[model samples]
Target: MPEKEITRISKFLSLVLRHQPEKINITLDENGWTDVATLIQQVNKSGSRLSFEILDFVVANNNKKRFAFNPDKTKIRAHQGHSVEIKLGYPPQTPPAVLYHGTSEKNLASILAEGIQKRNRHQVHLSPDKSTALTVGQRHGKPVILQVDAAAMHAAGLVFYLSENQVWLTGLVHAEFLHVLTT
Candidate 1:
């Protein structure tokens, strides 16, 4: 897939799944899920266009096994509240391993500009060496070290494992990680 396409899908996963809706100050249904129409509207409001079909395609075609269908396929939600949904797909096998979450207190723009720029994976493993990680921690007014179990994610139907790798970076991770690592 094109790099830009990957980046776009990654960002959607982070915003809709990993980040807390309350942080964004949006209310969710009692089921903790949002409707596909509302989700599309939110993306458009955010200056992005993410159709349900795109989400469906991503969830369906992702090689990494990051997304799944809700009980009815009429809606989509993260497998786990803590785990970001990277793509749109239902996997045959559950994922095994743990995922790490990096929280930031910074506003969404800064977080995006610095944290999620050019990532290939669905989730990210955070470290102190990265400025985005530190910024996320600083913004939150606290240090963040998140350890998430992929198998648990799989069981909850939030995250599907792509490979056997134990750790993953959020697909929505800031592009700076790529820029910094590439440089």
Candidate 2:
């Protein structure tokens, strides 16, 4: 398929898999896994054409590695970023000394005072590197990157989970553990 088509399908998949599966009349299991056949059927039935071949291509070629298939290729799920209530079942992992979070410059003041909160999503999304954080921030507005003291947070009894896509996950980062890296 063409790149544009792939991108469109990928976004739609993210929407369904991460945020609104009901829109397509499919349901993700407790661990967020959904039957691949059901997903394709539901997607097509929803008036957005999807085939196994296209789904496979999208899963394989997604730039961020946002989705994954089961060992037998019969099931699929988003790696993370679920807005709906679903247990991702990621085990707590040791993160690096520091992680990064990207956001709009406009939010810096409030963030400096209030710390990073998960808001609507399951957890505060973090990046393993500044570049990735910058990209994430740019999506909102003028990018701002914040350095997180992950080691310190972990030492303080906070837990972290690294998603399959390599995005870090944590409950929240208090202002004490955050350092403004770029405005």
Candidate 3:
């Protein structure tokens, strides 16, 4: 398929798998997984053509590795960024000494005072590197990157999870553990 087509399908999959499966008449399980066949059928029935082969291609070629298939390939789910309530089932893991969060410059003041909150998403997403965080921040507006003291947070009893896509997940980063890296 063409790149544009793949992007379209990928975004649609992100929408359904991460946020609104009901829009396509499909439902994800408590762990955010859905039957692959059911997803293909429901998406096609909803007027967007989708097939196993196309789905496979999209899953394999997505740049961010946003989606993942179960071990048996019978189920699929987004790696993270779920707005709907669903347990991701990621085990608590030790993160690196530092992690990065990207956001728009406009939000810096509030973030400085309140720290990073998950808001609508399941967890506050963090990047292992500043470049990735900068790219993520650019999506919102003028990018701002924040350094997170992951080791300190972990030592303080906060837990972290690494999603399949390599995005770090945590409940929140208090202002004490956050430092503005770039504005």
Candidate 4:
């Protein structure tokens, strides 16, 4: 795909699935999912009309498995962030400590690699307590937390911890840790 087209799709996915839609001033649904009609309207309002074909093509070609057509294929939802449904897709033997998310913005299958090991997008080294975890999730959109192997994250050098009232950092785990703890 052309670089511009790729960037457009990336932005589309970001706004649709990621909570960072505010970065572009596009407000998504409370659940962060917007129907196809609504999305088309948004596009039209932007002085760009995205046809159904283009929308389907973009959704199909998106790397992240963030967007999904509803069961009836009528509405679409960005299945990003926290999901109440328990994805027992992982093996029962696996311990809970680190959760994996697809950083891909192209293929959704890459986001779900059953059985095989995976990596996290931002290895958030949060306090190992529920209250703290919930507190850390505050101010930001509520994030889903699947049990992950904390030991693996620590071993792979992808763990970052935030102080009691701070949780803003974007870099390698070490830099993020310093920034969060120091600030």
TM value for model 4: 0.41
RMSD values, in order shown: 12.1, 1.1, 1.1, 14.5
Per-prediction TM-score to the true structure, in the order listed: 0.40, 0.96, 0.96, 0.41
Q: Which candidate leads the pack in lDDT?
A: 3
Candidate 4's C-alpha runs over 4 A off are 1-3, 20-30, 81-148, 151-183
Residue 62 displacement (Å), model 2: 0.6
- lDDT for model 2, on a 0 to 1 scale? 0.93
Weakest ten-residue segment in model 2 by summed lDDT: 174-183
In candidate 1, stretches whose alpha carbon ends up further than 4 angstroms from where it belongs are 1-3, 22-26, 29-31, 81-183
Model 3, span 21-99: residue lDDT tens: 9998999899999999999999989998888999999999997899999999999999999999999999999999999
Give all candidates' CA lDDT scores.
0.48, 0.93, 0.95, 0.42
Task: Show pairs that collide, candidate 3.
Answer: none
Which 10-residue window in model 3 sums to the lowest lDDT? 174-183
Number of clashes recorded per candidate: 27, 0, 0, 11
Residue-wise lDDT of candidate 4 within 1-183, one digit each (tens)?
555785586566555445454433455555444566666666676676577777677667764434666566556655433222212121212223543221222222332333212234322333344444444344345433233344564566643343212321112322221111111
Q: Which candidate would rank higher by TM-score, 1 or 3? A: 3
